[model samples]
Target: MLYSDKAPDPVGLYPHARRVGNLLFLSGVGPRKKGSKDIPGVTLDNHGNIIAYDIEQQCHAVFENVRFILEASGARWENLVDVTVYLTNMKADFATFNKIYATYFKENQPCRTTVEVNALPTPIAIELKCIAAFEDK
Candidate 1:
């Protein structure tokens, strides 16, 4: 099991990542900063409903959180093999997300799947689940 002090706390009771054999499986990572409930680029109303969000900002933050978990699990960014992205508003966010994603994944192109969802566990707009592989040295 792996936990990262630099990554945001998971909404559920789960570690950041778990390593088995040569693979590390990361839990869903969001844009919230470590030890903070305020999600990046998200503006919520008084009732805690999302009023506005910046997909680009959320994308960068979630990627950084994923990096933190991968480092905690003894993996490298280049070792990422797969990524699953969940977006609350695909129609509004997909293009922006793809643009930001390409900038980070220019060299290490992992297999990816993106889907639209109604919402996440938090007010965040984006989340990522990842898998990485490394030699069992």
Candidate 2:
């Protein structure tokens, strides 16, 4: 079986959830509003936005955006088994990353790796991509 979801006015990416058999592959989600983009932050609504450039806040926002994807798929963070994080500067943000990560997955603790890169599309600090699964029977 296959599944998908699309929410207008809140995001540009639609069909956010994709299911292949028992596994669900989610796109890299970032915090953004319906008309605008996910620049960074918690205050982003229909019009206003908040810019969260700090590593801690940036990482948290990414995960919070991810949470929406997970929920759309009828799953939760705990359903995640593996994750890949891309960072523009790993050394400067390691501690902050671990701290915010714990708040989201302290118990589930998905297999993950943090890697440093040249940069992302935005000036924001980090981006996260994940894979989640469940029994398909």
Candidate 3:
């Protein structure tokens, strides 16, 4: 079944998450606010060009969005087993993103893979695709 509404409306034709048995696969989540196109920590020029952005802020917003989706599906942050991060500026943002990520995962650090990309669906600097095990094997 499709899951949504706990976070912003998706930017594409996909659900927030898909469940197969006890596992939930979350789509690539970004930092856009619910019900609007505003992205946290992003500074845009008058013509809508990106002037600046804080990776840490974007990262936190993305995680919070993921948290909402997980909670709405009866899962928690600890349930996340894996995460794939996409960044537009790995060289410039990895340290900041890592620092913020450490605060969120703490003892429940899931395996992660981060990669630099050319862009995202939106103008945000980061996005996350995650998986959670909601049931014991």
Ranking by TM-score: 1, 3, 2
lDDT of 1: 0.91
lDDT digits (tens) for residues 24-69 of candidate 3? 9998899988998789999988887789998878988999999999
Across residues 32-118, which tens digit of lDDT does each residue of candidate 1 receive?
999887888889999999999988889999999999988888789999999999999999899999999999999999999999999
Expressed as tens digits, the lDDT of each residue in 1-137 for candidate 2 is 22223221223444566777768777655444334554554343454432335666667667766777777788888889888888877888888888878888878988898888886654556777688987566
Worst 10 residues of 1 by lDDT: 128-137
| Each model's lDDT | 0.91, 0.66, 0.90
**How close is every model to the real structure, measured as TM-score?**
0.97, 0.74, 0.94
On TM-score, the stronger of 1 and 3 is 1
Candidate 3: which stretches are off by over 4 Å? none
Off by over 4 Å in 2: 1-15, 41-52
Candidate 1 — which residues are off by over 4 angstroms? none
Best-matching candidate per lDDT: 1
Could you tell me how far off, in angstroms, the CA of residue 62 lies in candidate 2 after the best superposition? Answer: 0.9
Q: Which structure is stronger by lDDT: 1 or 2?
A: 1
